[model samples]
Target: MTLADHHHDTSPSRPTGLGALGRPAEVRTHPLDMTSTAEVDAVRTALADAGLLGETVRFAFFAPEEPPKSDVLAAAPVDRRFRAVLLDLATGRSTDNVVSATSGDVVSTRELDPATEGQPPIIDAEFELIEDILNVDAGWLAALAARGIEPASVRAVPLSAGVYDYPGEVGRRIVRAFGFQQDHERDHPWAHPIDGLVAYVDLTARTVDRVIDAGITPVPTASGNFDDPAYVGPDRETLKPIEITQPEGPSFTVEGNHLTWQNWDLRFGFNEREGLTLHQIGFDGRPIVYRASIAEMVVPYADPAPVRFWQNYFDCGEYMFARYANSLKLGCDCLGEIHYADAVLADDLGNPVTISNAICMHEEDFGVLWKHADMFAGSAETRRQRRMVISFFTTIGNYDYGFYWYLYLDGSIELEAKLTGVVFTAAADSEYATQVAPGVMAPYHQHLFSARLDMTVDGVGNAVEEVEAERIPMGPGNEYGNAFRQKRTRLTSESQAQRSADGSVSRAWHIVNPSVQNSLGGTVGYALLPEGQATLLADDASSIHDRATFATRHLWVTRYDPAERYPAGDFVNQNPGGAGLPAWVAADRPLDGEDVVVWHTFGTTHFPRPEDWPVMPVEHTGFRLKPVGFFDRNPTLDVPPSRGGHCS
Candidate 1:
């Protein structure tokens, strides 16, 4: 399903009279759909009715709603319900409330201790309070002035405050903040690092708790501006313009959020947490994936500098970076025939806001799908390949990430994350960083994205098996040499299934519906092929190791549980350790003949070079899912060949 749209007009997917949500009213809201702005007000009203929400308590987080049980989803249409978390500023306690949007009633409530369960995700209101908090604190201003940078030169931006063993920060809603010098009005702060100055702002108290100045390292004066004319003298005229025109228009059709292209049928939805998510993916009316999304990702820096050591960001869970998703531009972000879908989400004040053309969908010609030349028959046949692309881009701090989902003419699903942006910089003395410029050193980091694939190959009763190409020894049955076969091992349980990508052995994990069979009498399946890059470089003893255990392995298979959506647990803001996947799979749930979800960790470990300075080029990383036993034969035999159009 594709949602990448290039148009920023007041356009929506479908006509719906119900509020500002793009989802059509008749099309019943899927459990994976985004929480509507109308539902946010209904939830606030419902909480107030139960005397849990008021002036003293602030809405901390309304996380991505969890679905009902597996059976309930396959049954009749269900009513709309939501679960929200609120923090009492007076007592530093979080109360979880489940509200029914259908009836506008509060169904359940539970109070959690910040000391035990970690604090809720950072809210938008809390970020808004930072400027006021910093402006009032004279110490923060003095710290900025001490670095020879005015307080007005840097903005008081709030960041996801990670956890250490600090006694004062324990059990508090903390947001780590720092400053970057902007000498001019349009200066990019990322280029100039006001290093060694950090502040811990307590959101609950609405004050700057403390500011740490680890001796001011020289602020980088290099200009990081790439768009300005001052950076480049002239434009290159060597490259000519290429036009991609589908005069007949794209083959894909969209009705509301539902998308159908070639033989594939799927639906896509968006939320504040995860920008774009796909659901109900099927090929020729046979189910493949029930729900799929980029559930969580961690960007952990390897530098050990005090100001940079605690640099790990959970972009989706902690910051809800999707709120900052870019409204894609036409010729630049997408080309060819495009279909755009407008995304709607609630603002900090529970008001509806629409990011027009936030999602983009397009098609691209991909060389050839199949080709054959028969010398005996004096005939040649070739069929070109084309894939439908669905993507969205979001900017978080210094980096911008683009998550793309591509569906091909054949039964294949692929997710590609394009990384491009200015790299986070520090002073040039660190051993773990590369001095990209005279004074700017970019640290080494990894962007490990955990893709959650809720697969239902033919049905929910599916299992995962690790497939590897094993080399047979040169003996026994083979007296000569050259004997190799594949070894398939059914992952029976959760703990035993934790594995790494071994490209040396050509390893891949396959999700198969063992209960179903194809024409060859083999189990219907799809294979997950990873690029097999390195996992988290952080050791098990590090704090980030505990918070992002999902990155410890390339693959993790667990029985489908609606509650287990996030890989790094629910509250990853300031988690200590052992909370998410590591804690959930400790029970070692059996995965045989059960509905299972595959979390594939795929990313690149960046060691910045001189060419990566200023603005870095796009680096690509992703995984693929191809039909294994699901198809009896070639699925694209009916595809027509291109007509003759040659140029001299």
Candidate 2:
């Protein structure tokens, strides 16, 4: 028997029912019914098992690049045109609002000519295609359910043009058209551009179910010492009353020299020193600050068209205002004031002494000064006088987390004015400079000299100390009587790196006494060293003074980390106890005893409101510094009166 010759047709005979050719074995398990909740759950479960849950399962749909082809393109025959007119007459009104159109509106015709039709058969065809696509997607979902997959949620977004331009309204329209309701209604649209139209079905097990039932109701009336009546009275507001959406683990504690606070259950904190608690305040409260409405600010610049312009104008305005408000409240000002003068005196060793006491202002004032400089730079008369006005301001807020306990969170603002832009001599170019003597010279590098201000938090409490100092080189300079020149190198490398990386570097500069000498027979001004104590020698006398110093101000804020489960949102870190402080205080070189001064102002931040949620509106508030004579005269005395009409 020739076994090899025996051939049996064993191609796995097709099933009696629908075979793989009709429907794949996998898809054959489920029917295309989308109404059943059980089917939906099954689909979600299947998707989760396949690791296609949440963001991974969204389906994106793309339109064909080319338009559909037709057999006839020339002018239609008389009968065909007439038929098109009849179809158009019937469906013309239905086309006004596609949202209301039904399956019946879909008209199939062999006329093949759209020119004669009111409902240009093309539109009906397009509608039918859309319906088919939707049905197919629904079937896929049903199949997933039959596989025992349950999806978290199915979100359908229309990828048609003009949909994203007005998201808030368009999103609502889509929801209404699709017969789907949003868990929470958002005033503005949340749609963003993707590669194409896609339905994202999130099927994650972690879903937020804890609902905060009580709405945030604004207090009709409140009064406090702060003039703007919007301030909630000292004892009025309480975080305990409001229910937080999510409460997490035990409270965390942050302790520092000037401030300390404990995070509580509601994401609020209790300030130990102030005996008050901080709550997340929203924009709905009293007008604590001056603000510009988005409509008033953006309308004039938008198009005049009734619908499109207003809608766009409002959306644009909200977005801009939100960003501006957040930055103004939370961002830090790093730029410091520059000072210069006529004849600065020097000490015996040629170091510049009596550095014509100039005031350093905050970044905001510096911005004003910069603007003024630009406007007045063209004036020949102003340039000749060399009369520079150095401007800066100081900001103070309750010690980090200080607002946690207090009823009224507050910040003080102070403006400082001084003359800057005056040119000074570099240490390398001075005649008074000398070679470094091995044993006698303290250090060849640059030295930072500062003075300490010791004060007690309370009369009975331990003395809390703060340091202030002026940075000046003692190596070469003339006293007030002589025309002395102070020489400083351009430090091309450091300057270039600093300029290029502006605003990105976070570490502060540490000032230390120098010990090395260069071949040029001159000592480097300030030595770059770790944050630690260094002795300051008087410009004239080689006497060294030992001073204990630390950072007086640090940029600290409350931020939420998505990973943490504790008080939901809380402050995570406070960087202190370092020698090199923030850049606002000059780094790279040490300051002369008179160059450094410690000043502070305060500020507050609040959560955004529903009105502010889509786009926040701009708000403004300012603080005034009483005449403390930090300057020789009232800094604002010389300021010219504002051009009458120019006041904002």
Candidate 3:
């Protein structure tokens, strides 16, 4: 059936028993009281303005009745004590509270769809809207209170649908409470929280009591002590005994020997101003030679008698002797000059004697010295006086993974530079604003900037593998890409504009340099051309220059090199150096072309204060380099950095 045809008449039959008994038979209905007075007027004005309250309109209120008794022979009387009023808009009879208390009867039927055109049913939609509006009002009310305001903890529960029986009065109450009018087509933003929930006015704090009676639990306090009880009733089942053990000593004794002047030799040859003393000897019976001063002065010695010590030593004499012999033979000083005399000596019968000098050394110092010796022995060109080197300097924050330096070495002209750390931008923090144009300052104001360098080595004009590397941020404010924001600035001017026929279109450009210092006022590094002219390059240009433009890009840092201009143990104040620039080289090596300078910096950008512990995050920064133009165009560029490999 069509929508209009589905409308069923629900008028109640005339009363019987009450009129027959002559019990003051006046039928009347009372008006439904709206929570607010303003809502009633608003509904009246709205209905009148919409032309729904004139001759063609009619409004009525009804309370549903109980089912009839089975034994009744006569029709039961309508419950006239339950009153309702019908409005005949045609006669303009719209008086307030005009219904008398003696009318009751309502029609009931199956539910019908409410989406009919030109005549949408208001039952479900109106109740739903009222509920939502009430919820929003409650939220606003809580917000207005001086205390007990909890935005996250607020909630709403609907009461009943019977309150909508007086639509006109109900509508007025809602309008007065929320300062808005109800319209099927227009939605108000303030009404969002109240939608689809029942509205209730708790004049006597009855709402809370009603809610409790309906079996809802109250919300727990946010700061209630939940941990105290938990600790008092700790579970013993989860406890277990912990075992401790004492640290054991070394497996064997570390024996050492000393060299004497007897292992020296005098040389008298042509053009010899002073005789050069030499020591010829054997290491565990293996022949070796060393300078007399190095042999006599560099070896360690103890006070114990040699034969007595050897006899009194613990078991495993052979193993101990072998370890001692191997360690002594391999030991060398910072210059890579092996002291063979310490491991060898003159035999009693004119044959070379073998001496043992083996002692455990600190891992860090030993590593440094070992590398120094290896680099010196491998390259003959750097055997003479070492040249001064230049290095890069940067302070990375504590959270940084590490720094990277880009170096270009082609067995010819070498150049080096570095880029700062990496920062990542998250979508949650990024927003699109209608007020600002896309790709403008507003979009990138807090955006993070990072660089990825891909270097390829070409061999015989053919492209080989490419090496990819990334630098990441290291300190506080790193979580939101703030670290990058502090070190770089986006060019928002027309300088980054692209030329068009009509005019110029603005394009975003990232310019990176040490000029953009962090709050600490210390910059990462400076850039200079081959001619020593300094200039800041665009981010893309910097990447390309570091990758393939230069013959060799040296990634150096300014570090305190104690051996550069002072004795081994001389004290020097920490400074950038007199010249403000110096050659960058690994600590263990002499500055030379044979070794590619891999630079690193170590220091605090800002001095620590008493408040900094438990060691606040410090800013540290550095760079990395891949061989771009270093080889013949492109070689095996995909090789990863070696864990134990030195540049030389």
- lDDT of all the models against the reference? 0.80, 0.18, 0.20
The local distance difference test score of model 2 is 0.18
Q: Candidate 2: where are CA atoms >4 Å away?
A: 1-601, 605-617, 622-627, 630-648
User: Candidate 1 regions off by >4 Å?
Assistant: 1-37, 55-58, 63-66, 69-73, 88-93, 135-139, 644-648
Which candidate number has the best lDDT? Answer: 1
Q: What is the lDDT of residue 642 in candidate 1?
A: 78
Q: In model 3, which runs have C-alpha deviations exceeding 4 angstroms?
A: 1-570, 573-613, 617-620, 632-648
Q: What is the TM-score (0 to 1) of candidate 1?
A: 0.92
Best by TM-score: 1
> Per-candidate TM vs. native?
0.92, 0.16, 0.14
Instruction: Point out the worst 10-residue segment of candidate 2 by lDDT.
Output: 395-404
Alpha-carbon deviation at 373 in model 1, angstroms: 0.7
Ranking by TM-score: 1, 2, 3
Per-residue lDDT tens digits for candidate 2, residues 374-468, read 45555321111111122211111100110101111111112121111101011111122221211110111111211111110111011101112
